[model samples]
Target: MRTLIVSEFITLDGVVDSPGGGDHPHAGWTFKDVEFDEAAYEIKGREQEEAGCLLLGRQSYDEFAPVWPSMDEFAEYNAMPKYVVSSTLTDPEWTHTTVLRGLDEVAALKESDEPGTILVHASARLAQGLAAAGLVDRYHLLVFPVVLGSGKRLFSSDAAKTRFTLTEHAAYANGVQLTVLDVVR
Candidate 1:
């Protein structure tokens, strides 16, 4: 079976919203303390290399579509097939992009006998639903140093209590914590 992996950049307090520049008051918070180096890019590249496809939410797709295609660093990500979970998105402009209506479609993807991982990036509500449904197989979180107390969190109050076993962890010099976890259910 294919593994559904969630790759998130979260704050120490669990806030996952708008790690990139956006309307969130703590916009670009993830970049505030960390100094990007060769090792950071290597870590990111390794994650992308493990994924055969990119699974994203509507908002994440919308935000990434315009920028990633233009950047050389994200060429591998842009080349991979992308499935965006959304009920409202009809037409997607990105290449090799498909719009999945809901969780049913996501489940279908998980059931497929694909070889590599289905990497989910920066999609909080979708990730929550996937976790609640017990569809997520693994989580790769790059936890930043700062805390944003008021933004949307990775796990909402109403989220199901899903336990995860930490398989590996690495702490970068820039105070970034990289954790690899598997769902314990």
Candidate 2:
């Protein structure tokens, strides 16, 4: 079975909204910090290389579809198979993109005999759902040293109280903390 991994750029208070600048008031909080080290990039590269597929929510899909396809850094990621869990996205313009409608599809994807990890990036709503449904196998949270007092958070009131086991942790020179945790299933 394939493992579902959630990768997020979050704040000190667990706000995972718009790390790459968006419509939010404090969108570019992550970019303000400039102290990241080579180790951070190494971790990111490892995750990218290990991913068999990319899973995204509608919001993240809309945000990334236009930008990633044209970027050289994301060439390999763009080439990887991608599935977006979106009810509203009727047409997907990105290559190798598929739209999945509900949690059952996600469960099926996880239960399949696919190799490598299924990575979910910056999809807070989808992450919550996956956590609630106990579909997420691991979480790699890159926690920035900033606090966005108001925004969409990673865990909501409706989210299930899921437990996790800390598998790895790393501190970057740029004050970023990479915490890798496994879902205690």
Which segments of model 2 are wrong by more than 4 Å? none
Task: Summarize candidate 2's per-residue lDDT along 1-185 as a digit string, tens digits.
Answer: 89899998888998988787998887777776546466776667888889989999998999999999999988878999999998888889999999999999999998888877999999899999888888999999988888878888888977767788999998888888899999886
- How many Å off is the CA of 33 in candidate 1? 3.3
- Candidate 1 displacement at residue 166 in angstroms: 1.1
In model 1, which range of ten residues has the least summed lDDT? 33-42
Model 1 lDDT per residue over 38-136, tens place:
554455788788898999999899899999999998998889899999999999999999999989898999889876799999989888888888889
Q: What is the TM-score of each candidate against the true structure?
A: 0.95, 0.95
Model 2 residue 108 CA deviation (Å) reads 0.6
